[model samples]
Target: MENYMMSGEGEKNSSDVVYLCDEVFDFSTVSSAFFILIFILSVTGNVLLLFVLAIYEDLKNITNLFILNLACSDLVFTVTLPFWAAYYLHHWIFGDFTCKFMTAAYFVGLYSSVILLTAMTVDRFITVVLHNWWSSPVRRRRYAMAACAAAWVISIAASVSDAIKVEVETSWNNLSTCEAPSDGPDIKLGYYLQVSLLFFLPFVIIVFCYSAILKTVLQATNRKRYRTVVVVLCIVAAFFICWGPYNVLLFVMSMYDPRGCNEIERLYIAHSICRILAFFHCCMNPVLYLLSQKLRTHLLQLLHCKCVRIKCKERGTATTVIQNVAFIAQNSAVTLDPHSK
Candidate 1:
């Protein structure tokens, strides 16, 4: 969950005074509980979204494919939440290998999700801005597949820098924490990389795409197109709003030299809360699906079908029980009146 070194130890000032603020705003248990909640919601929501897309929506559509990948990226990110929850409550007991893997996988999920969102924006821009640009459906599908693959590759590569340097270290409190080494130049590299790739680049691309999309939609009288654009804009807006503060704080922390205990403690609290907010973004996408008429319809139809199937199953069970009871009654009657027959 944390790609940078945490202030888990004391720091010395000019007068030989050591400042340790580990006891300040102690909310480890609460944070862990919230993480568990996020895990459950994110898993349930993304899984349901994927199911609906697979059953009720066409994968051949590039937008749906991007959506499917985005959900998968969210799942990949969310699966790490339980481990993070445990780490928050206690320490890293999973060992070095898992620490590396989970950290890498987490970043991979984060990076790919951002990239996929950017790609989705571009796809929308193309569809709306360049409507007349035609190509074979097969070629377009291939291009979409390539974009998905590239996003994963780039994410994995970016994650390696953080994962390889990660190790389990015993902090000043005698608790083992998983974190990147603070000794090397790589200490600051992760923060800068994240700020650029995860936030800055994606923000620029999304802003440009949506601006073009809005201009085109406004000039035309197409309500459907305008509505779809608005929904996507909302999604993009939510993503940035949740992650923007976290990235900004991270960048500041990378360059920050805390002058006192209060400063350090305040930054720690802010960072932890911002991270939780950032993680919550994974769950937001599925909720945002409610804004999309197509996805909403798919979800409703899926629920309706499940309800209908359950009712049919119950009715069939009741009818079989009734038939069995009637057959037994007739047999009893025949046995009791054998001579009458």
Candidate 2:
């Protein structure tokens, strides 16, 4: 049986196992709108975060570096959202090159974000749990830089591996689509790899690191234990909630054989919903820092500086206008007093 690929929430055609589903709902328009909204939010939030970090935070700090890289990763995913939105609204209008490139870029962003998040968790684990394992700031800085570079490289490699399988071709619906080949094995393999690396692996690592950190905090009699635990739980829960369903649904759908129209349609609907939820994750990181005192302080300082500059410019303009008016009045008086002269 032919098997299709699902990338960026768009489906490819699989002819041999075709099942005509009853039109319970038309999700294309809604999906397109959601994608557009997500794109806007992700871009705005991530860009603002990046700007704040660049201007007010030290890049040498591992945490700040990870935050910067994560924002970039979100941006990379977001920049491709419009294209996918267009694909949902219409057929795949763009040709082969964009098809491959966008797919790869999207995957790169996804994988990079997961990697960076995991890296950040590990860094925190080292700082708290290990407590003195790596005492040198310079060494930590070098390692952090290397980690970021390696994350990008690995993400790119994974993305390219699957991206090479994508192509622009006619779907079973007779519309052009960007999709993987009609090979069941390839589709299954890709889904398995994605579920393993993207979801399961990172999720496990993050949980383990956070659990250790929480234990450390508990034993230390720290006053901030409750707050730390809550924050840790929220971080882990948010990641799982956003992406867990999407990956699970994808894995199930890859292995499932829908026997009826209703079953097929239900899967499609669920997949669409879960995929949108996953897309919402691009903006979630910014929310985690919404209550950060340092970030708020930096943002306020930046705004104050901007306001001060504007006021100075206005004062300078007012002074110049006043001087010009005085000069004009004096010149007019001199001209009018010609008889006296």
Candidate 3:
């Protein structure tokens, strides 16, 4: 809040120096384009996945509950991307109120995703590693739903806490920017908290879960279940790969303050890129990618069946017409006879 200045940076006293405005702002267009594309793909992909999950009766299992919630989280995140693209293209026009709301929702999406993924991992751990003893305590779907509900609640709380720190600068080139508060300590603390809970902790837990699962698989030489195990493990690994760089960069920024204008600019560019990469993760979940394959197969089968049905209907109609015409002709010939034959 204290950092933004358009024409009066030089007038400020030396102790209050903060925030460097971009001289060119040239990256905004490119960033906007990339973000728009991400938004489109995320929305399109997640919506179809959600539809498939909703319709497919057999997929309504505990594991799929988490996957469904993940898709929901992605949709929520995708909704915010367009706003952000608009913000980058033209400064925040929606005012501070919408800014706070958008920022909160944006973080809610992210935090919920991480929380859900962790929940999924822990559920898998229990199912695979401790299946006989662990799951007896609770019903799987009910428990998974409860966990997802708790995640949503926790995510809302976290987002609101972070949203309080958002501030609006109104006159940045006659536009407003809703950004994190410019308090150094607060920014550092936010970064630390985010990196720890959202990335590091989740990453560690997933790794631990998978390690145990892998050990379990190694001991029992059932090659039949190995493929499913491997696929789930790869999904978890991809989650980390997608989000790791962004969190690492965020940590680095928290630890190292940008000193000079050039350093600041470079860091700014890097941060922008990392933010895009991080946001793009909402669209690239492992579960969704796996589900996409199944969905594609199902859709193709449905289309093929539909085509067959259409052909069958066409043939049936033609046969019915021919039969009716033959009956009419026979009746006409019968009627044309002077005497009954």
Candidate 4:
């Protein structure tokens, strides 16, 4: 799609970019299916995760705090997805405030998740790889919270500026859009910051952590060490699988566009596909994190209680059903080691 003009300005430029690219492919079919599926999975997974955390575990632990923060970040992205889905089919009609808020929230989700995941890896590094120097419990929790706060502040500051600059654009046939216009320096800076903070630095930390963990676990006698390595690897893999290609592709595009129109078209199409793939990371968090053995035990107990309740109902034992529900709720409580990473 071609476009141009300031908000409510006079005639727009006959040719304009949609989504910072030369052309906007009609990706409604591709977008609609993926967005809806992601929305459902992300919502269900994150919500279940939040519920499990609130009911079964205390958030006072530093590790749980990071997990909670990550889930909230995923939820931030998930909540705004419907609007984006609508925007894909019909351009952004949600007005300026919503355009800014939703777009910024999307960045918050992306940036914050990367940051938190990085933070989690760092914590694990200290706790596992350098256990001898691990600090006091109180100090560890305080420092973890401080790290989380720093990440939030940085991610928001980096992302919110460009998001706020987003204004509605009227494209062909008067369809409105929420793209931020490209200013060469600003876009280059945004892309640089995004690739650096949101992907590169975090990726390095995660890899270092797992590498260190691998060396230690291989030497250690702890049975749980291998399990920790496996889970951490799954997480690191998920992060890269979802965000890696998109980050690399965008960074390259930002650096230089030697390609002609056809190449631009193909690159943007790949970008669109990467975006759809990246969004699925939000949903994967629950499966990867909350499905830990301890949480799984609680889930199985919950299911067992439901079965008992059903049998009690068949037996016409109203009191037993109530008792079963109470029993299940009590069983949900789990004590997680705060520094277990």
* C-alpha lDDT values of all predictions: 0.83, 0.78, 0.72, 0.74
Name the lDDT value of residue 171 in candidate 2: 59
CA displacement after TM-score superposition, residue 79 of candidate 3 (Å): 0.6
Q: Please say which candidate is ahead in TM-score: 1 or 4.
A: 1
| Estimated TM-score for each candidate | 0.85, 0.82, 0.81, 0.80
Indicate the residue-level lDDT of 228 in model 2. Answer: 35
Alpha carbon RMSD to native, model 2: 6.8
Best candidate according to TM-score: 1
Q: Compare candidates 2 and 4 on lDDT and give the better one.
A: 2
Cα lDDT tens digits, model 1, 1-341, are 56444444434232355576655666577778888999999999999999999998899988789889989999999989999889978899999999999999899988998898898888778878987664777876888889999999999998897798788888677888898755446666756766786779889999999999888988897567467677778888988888888888888876766778777667777888888898899999999978888888888887799798999999999999999999999999988995966
Model 4 clashing residue pairs (backbone): 1-24, 3-16
lDDT of 4 by residue, 197-260 (tens): 6789788878888889778878888757456557656876897899788777766655544334
lDDT: which candidate is best? 1
Greater lDDT among 2 and 3 belongs to: 2
Poorest lDDT segment (10 consecutive residues) of candidate 2: 1-10
Predict model 2's lDDT versus the native.
Answer: 0.78
Collision pairs in model 2? none
Model 3, runs deviating above 4 Å: 1-25, 135-138, 226-228, 259-261, 286-288, 291-293, 301-309, 315-341
User: Candidate 1 or 3, higher TM-score?
Assistant: 1
Candidate 3 lDDT tens digits, 222-337:
76655556656665676677778777876675556555465666666676776677777777763445544565665455447779899999999999999999999999999999
